[model samples]
Target: MDNLVKKVKEGIWSGRTDHLENKESFRYHQIVELAQLDTLDTEGKACVIIGFESDEGVRRNKGQIGAAKAPNELRSELAKLPWHVSSEKYVVDIGTIDCTGNDLEKAQQQLGDVVNQVLTKKMTPIILGGGHETAYGHYLGVRNYIGKAAKLGIINIDAHFDLRPYDEQPSSGTMFRQILEQDENSSYFVLGIQRYGNTQALFDKADELGVIYICEEDMHGEQLVQVNKAIEEFFQNNDFIMLTLCTDVLNAAFAPGVSASSPFGLSPNTVRSIIRIVSSNEKTLSFDISEVNPLLDENNRTVKLGAYLVNEAITSFLN
Candidate 1:
């Protein structure tokens, strides 16, 4: 273990490779370096990527367990990104957070540790995922740092609202519900939600809770400008914002490796556009991208797209 940790450290700081390459078993290894809690700017701000591998809820679906390997797959692709983009320095001190044996309690605690450290230094935390159920953990990190009374909020870009009732036990689908229930003033705006998969029960809960829901069909033909406007409105009153990108938000053609592959959703271009608009705003406190099941991926397409999203996050931050 000592020798392995030494070797991993050497590779991360070696600077020969533009990015670090990783895999499922090796994926968590990359995260150990990421969780070092260092690498912040003089102002103590940095972007942290926490990639988790637990898929407890997805165990029921054979295809979903494969998503556990996504973060490792994404590392390889992200390393190849060009350094010089439009003269702004894309200096992301990337790292990962290890998942805790699919234990939600331990996982959230670990997540809270990294998130608290980042926020304490005033750095942004860009979390990758174990599952969207991590929203609860991620939000705990935010609310812990900013305090719940500060009007904390989240922005989800995906095909489902994920507001299933607490009785069902939280999955990727029930994270948003758990988040909103944390506080009534805690606002959550979900974009690109497909009208189909969401049960009437979920919709009713959203309506009663006053969670903002934007259907994919309604936004399908609309310009990126229109979508950005709505996002801006939802975020206008919030003090701290957590951004979530569920791969299912990308049209199946672009992101087919997800557990819940849906027919209709935003094009990669639209996803890019939304990411740019939301991330560029200084209000963003932390972010996460979830549900890229590399096992189901074709030619590593989903990993490449996940890498692309990281690039967009850096570019958006710098711009």
Candidate 2:
């Protein structure tokens, strides 16, 4: 694990300032850094951000290849944002887990170890992703920390169900399926599933696996009341909740940097509301935003949106 992980480079915080008298003063880069993932001091902190800098699973899944570049891009953007809150305790940059020689499984295992380390200390783990594959790795860590029988529920905001079979080897498209196959106790509820994005076989697989999902239309229409009710019930049944947001779930105009952008996708406003609702609940444990591919992006829109979502979640978790 040590071989795969590296401390966040010092220069990532270059834009920091000490002008405390300024009304909109502090920024993210000003937050403290941890020497290592396990060395974090969670005394006055909301969460620690850890990056997974690998996209090999995307390559295996035959998606766009550039998602591997997302984590650093996210950090570069997140570091520049001003921290509006007035507290000394802030998020810690716990560095990243890089996949060397395209060894995806080892990287995910390393990630799982890091997530377990974070959980035991009672601090939230905010995993900045390499791909949707990060979701599976994040799940392994959560399951490891809470146990397979811990009544953990996963809330995924994605355009596709990502429950494709992994008979051979798992890839970005088969993470949720991998999770379900590994743990029958898994309860997953996917929101923002695009009707056009997934095939009928995948939908059948979701049903076969007893997965809960709401298509994009169902999430936006009057059915939202029922959707919230379902989500509330799911939350009540679970001891802990893990959240994952796939950038491709947003409309292309809002998140063009994703591996696959949706023309008819959920609005960022709607997604933020969901994040607020989910994070506000004390049961939510860990979170990650995945599938940001800047090589395909216009400007830095997707990564900025990813930072905003992380900030929103942290603020909700803190307050």
Candidate 3:
């Protein structure tokens, strides 16, 4: 626990520093700080940001590795975003659970611990991820907080099912499968699954696990109504809902910085709409965005999209 909270130093060029008119015109860098999670009082309502800095999951999965550095990049970009919900909700920056020495499992365990703590405090936990593997850690925390019997609904916006078998060990591609295997009561839903991105074995695994998914091609072209209905039904049935987004689910044109870029994945607007839908539902417990590789990004497009999505989701929840 002592090593869990790594303080967030103000990033370079944090918010536009030149503005002086409203004095009240605010930005995230101005409000965010490294704070002790358990010590803060949100009165049962706050948004807690936690960073998951581990690429061992990616390495194990045999993907790119620079995503371990994504937490800080995400923070730097997020720091400049404008915030207008100070009165409605308090956004707490609870440092980061860095995978020091590249220890993925320990970092994940710590992430679960902090998430459980934040939930106990009755606050929402939003995780900035190192890779798709962050989903398992995020789920571990949610499960610890809510318990195994709770009906948990998982929504993944991605190009692939990420349900690959982890016979040897879990990776960025196997976390969802791990969750389902561990918890029978949990239900999983995925949007924007590219047909070409997944193999027959993965699709078979998803079907065997009873995972619900909409292919990228079907997510549009008159199938949108069914998509909305599916999401609504899932929300209604679950006791708590968790949303995880992997940037690789987006087309390379929009999200080229992911470990595995998609040639034809969902658009940002489509992804944002799904987030808003789930977020508006009060049962949505937590959200995490993953697989954003800033090292490979095009002018920080993936990072900025991530920041934009986070902003939109938080704004939706606050309102």
Candidate 4:
């Protein structure tokens, strides 16, 4: 047994497994330059990747362990993605977080720790996977760090407003609800929300909370103007912006691995255009892509696509 474990560690795995053969390996790939311990005094740039798999406990039971596997899978795929930006010049530390526990509060607290650590280093947190519910913790960290210094803006691309009543405690489907409760004055906008999934109650809540939602039918047919206008408005008010891309906002054909696969979503080109526009803006402090469940994916396509989106955003910064 010891020999088998040693061979797996030295051969198949990178010798960083949690146990002998039961746990997943670390999900980080430091393609860029590695920093020395002495450099701790300096503020370094980095993009943090995190995975949270307690979907069942969080009340988002779409992809099970697939959510937990996203950060590592996306990193593996990113290693192969051809970045349009030069590797050496663009030095970004890849900090991958592991959220293996089943407690939602505990998982969220752990995520909050990573967020604080990244912002402290003057690095933007480009997190991946876990669940949309993780956004609450992310926002908590942002509020704690920024602390009245900068007005915050939230740009969410999703198929649902996720503004369900704060009654059921808050899950992946209620992150924005918690977000609004925390900072109702913060500028928040939702793009590509399917008209069918959102309840009238949510629309009313959004209106009351000053949250903007651009529905799918409206965006695809006649609401393009509104979508563009909302983007402009969000930036005009808040200097610090966090953009979140929920894979379910894309049509199931493009992102079938999401927890709740929806048909009426933005096209790949449209989403890319949005990302490009946002990335080009100077206000964007950080970006995140969630709901990339590898288990539901047909052939690792979702992971690859998510990686491509990240690559495009990183490249856009160069342009």
* The candidate that achieves the highest lDDT relative to the unseen native structure: 2
- Candidate 2's TM-score reads 0.95
Candidate 3 local lDDT, 1-319, one digit each (tens): 5368787665632768545454358777765645787677867357888888888888988898878778778878887887777554667888878877757778788888998888888888889988888888898899999987889999999888888888988888888898899899999999998888889999999999999998999887578889999999888889999999998888799888988997788888888889999887899988998999988898999998988888777777767
Error of 1 at 153 (Å): 2.1
TM-scores for candidates 1 onward, in order: 0.84, 0.95, 0.95, 0.81
Query: For residues 1-319, could you state the per-residue lDDT of candidate 1 as single tens digits?
Result: 1111111123432223323652222222232233345544534234555655556645522336766676666666765555433322324434545554656656666667667766787767776665666566778888889875788768888888877665745566677777777686689888888888787887898898888878887775545567778888877888877788888888888888887888797888878888888888888887778888888889888888988887687667656
Model 4 regions lying over 4 Å from their true place: 1-30, 33-65, 91-95, 221-226
lDDT of 4 at 7: 12
Ranking the candidates on lDDT from highest down gives 2, 3, 1, 4
Model 3 is weakest, by summed lDDT over 10 consecutive residues, at 12-21
Instruction: Please give the CA lDDT of all the candidate structures.
Output: 0.68, 0.85, 0.84, 0.65
lDDT of 1: 0.68
* Model 3 C-alpha RMSD to native: 1.8
**How accurate locally is residue 269 in candidate 2, as Cα lDDT from 0 to 100?**
84
Distance (Å) between predicted and true CA of 241, model 4?
0.5
Q: Which run of 10 residues does model 1 get worst, by summed lDDT?
A: 1-10
- Where model 1 places Cα greater than 4 Å from the true spot, the runs are 1-35, 38-45, 60-63, 85-95
Q: How well does model 3 score by local distance difference test?
A: 0.84
Please give, for residues 151-229, the per-residue lDDT of candidate 4 as tens digits. 8898888888878765745567778877777774577888887878777887888898888777777766455666777
Which parts of model 3 have CA positions greater than 4 angstroms off? 18-24
Q: In model 2, state the lDDT of residue 239.
A: 93
